[model samples]
Target: MKRFCFTAVSLLVVPVTILVAGPAGNGECIRTPKGDITIHIINHATFALGWSNLTIYVDPVGPQARFAHLAKPDLVLITDIHADHLSVDTIREIITDKTLFVVPPAVAEQLAQPLCQRSTVMTNGQAATVLGIKIEAVPMYNTTRQRLQYHPKGRGNGYVLTLADTRIYISGDTEDIPEMRALKDIDIAFVCMNLPYTMTVEQAASAVREFKPRIVYPYHCRGSDLEKFKALVGTDLGIDVRLRDWYNK
Candidate 1:
């Protein structure tokens, strides 16, 4: 039930807090109209969000044991077909009979039997409502001409999930594209920044400034400079830039 406190300083990287003050829980909390949402960062692009009795897992991969400390998921969202984003083994280990999935069409093609049956395929710019949350599949891809093959437009998704009155944006793997820069009224955002795949830290910061989320968390950043990212998204914008240990696997 604890919340993170931020100052008016230009750049702040608050340490990750264990919301329930226990060894099993490791995440930060965000207040919503319905209840508090806990963000559990498992690793790279894998994380879980818990609000009320519902839990949503995003890009769950790696060993099943990696997710031992988090709450089970009621909904699962796969952003792309990359190995890190979609793993049949991890899904099999965590899914229950009642679990549902929301995925891009490319990701859906890779799922088998039951998981496929339980999934709803969403294309870029499409919207759906699941488990009381408004889900919008935003475009995520590489912008540079040479890097276009890494993540072609319409192949992957960046999600915009509206929980109660709070809006959360999860950038799967992308560059600073027009769609990302045009986002409006976002409460929390989880953006990606890594070379040879996603954008550079400078590009990521520029995109964040355009959208201006109240709180922004740099995630899926394997080797990008966190300090530079925080500085680029300066205090003048009144944006709270959080730097977490995403590679703490």
Candidate 2:
């Protein structure tokens, strides 16, 4: 097991600054009624959450060393069967006997036997509690006619996790569809924005404005302009736009 030592740094507005050793530089902490939920950014479309002595890895992909600093996950969530979002090799390297999984049916179909046995297949609008966290699978797909072939509806899922009553949303490869715009009471959201794969920054921003999560992180953004996304969201809405280094190697 890898051990981590965290030092608290000072940020003017937020009370805490997370300094940890890893490829994923600094972490952002969300103070919840129970404790702090630490977000460790691994790379595009991948992140790890630390809360309540358990680690939750979201769409874990890439080399095993990329996650060396983090603990083996108590739970892993696979959103889709796409290469970036699901990797059997990476999962095999990190999981232990106790690791649980929540995956979409499409993703579950692709998992190896051991992993499939540990997974709970959830479709859009399905809700279940795993490892003390309430997970609701939300629909994720493309709306534009040209992009329909990329991510067909009902094939993938966007996840909403309720941790200590703090609701978090992770948009797993999607466009700004009605489901995204209809989300309510979302505390934190990780939205995706790219070229033909997902919606543009403008479309992403427009959807965010409508749903109005308290904190929004523009993740899964490979080549999009994050500053423009932030500018479009603006401060008038009182949404905290956190720009993290999700593409760093």
Candidate 3:
């Protein structure tokens, strides 16, 4: 429900003062052929995606007040079962009867009966056309044996949303897996990079270099060095490495 604002901010990777929107330096709205897609970078992995009148909230894991400025979502996508990615209390407060909960199997199993009834469970490689949008569940897991328990291969998923002609990939907690590197026609990608939980900055950069998305935004990078990530991601690879403020209290 908040009004949109426009501004140009200089980022380390892109020299031309990238165009960004909204009060927070993190949020930006990208114009498309159909309509503009507004990315509200709430915090950490939590963010809201808006196009036209429809709103999609992804991994809303923070306090209720954090979401107060945004509009009530028509659809909510919970990537994984982790608390940082799925907050039960936060869902209860924001979700209405009309709101559809799109979640993975593990999350659907833990949800209450009423909430579970309103939810759609999608496994890896499965595709669902919900609310006029095509959502495909992609594989997400840790490659290292030590971090395997953090995110099992088939237990969770990363989602690829085809919003009009633009295909956006929201990577759930995952390492630089082969599946991620194999993605095609990805216009915008939100990749994760955190120590012990996900891949390192170098690994993330390497993966993006392989896939070569038009724009890559770094989120869920609480302890990771994003400056190094930007430096590692050269423009010659044809990727825009956007750095956002994900850690602000």
Top-scoring candidate (lDDT): 2
Looking at candidate 3, the ten consecutive residues that score lowest on lDDT are: 7-16
Question: What is the C-alpha lDDT profile of model 3 across 1-249, one tens digit per residue?
Answer: 222211112111111122333443444788776677889888899999987788899998877889887889899998998989998999989877888877888887778877776677788887777787778888989999899889999888799887877788899999999999998878889999998998899999999999988889999999999999988988797687889898784
Candidate 3: list runs displaced more than 4 Å.
1-27
> Per-residue CA lDDT of candidate 1, range 1-249, in tens?
222211111211122221221232477777554568888888999889987689999999988898888778899999999898989889999889898898887887787766777777788887777787778888999989888889999998899887777788999999999999998888889999998899999999999999998889999899899999999999998888888887767
For every model shown, what is its TM-score relative to the native structure? Answer: 0.89, 0.89, 0.89
Model 2 C-alpha lDDT per residue in residues 1-249, reported as the tens digit of each score: 221211112211112122222332456677665677889889999999988999999999999999998889999998999899999999999999989898887887787777777787788877777887888888999989999998999999899888876788999999999999998888889999999799999999999999998889999999999999999999999888989888877
TM-score of 3: 0.89
Query: Which residue ranges in model 2 land beyond 4 Å of their true spot?
Result: 1-26
lDDT of 3 at 21: 33
For every candidate in turn, the CA RMSD to the true structure comes to: 9.7, 8.9, 9.2
Clashes (N, CA, C under 3 Å) per candidate: 0, 0, 0
Candidates' lDDT values, in order?
Answer: 0.83, 0.85, 0.82
By lDDT, the candidates rank as 2, 1, 3
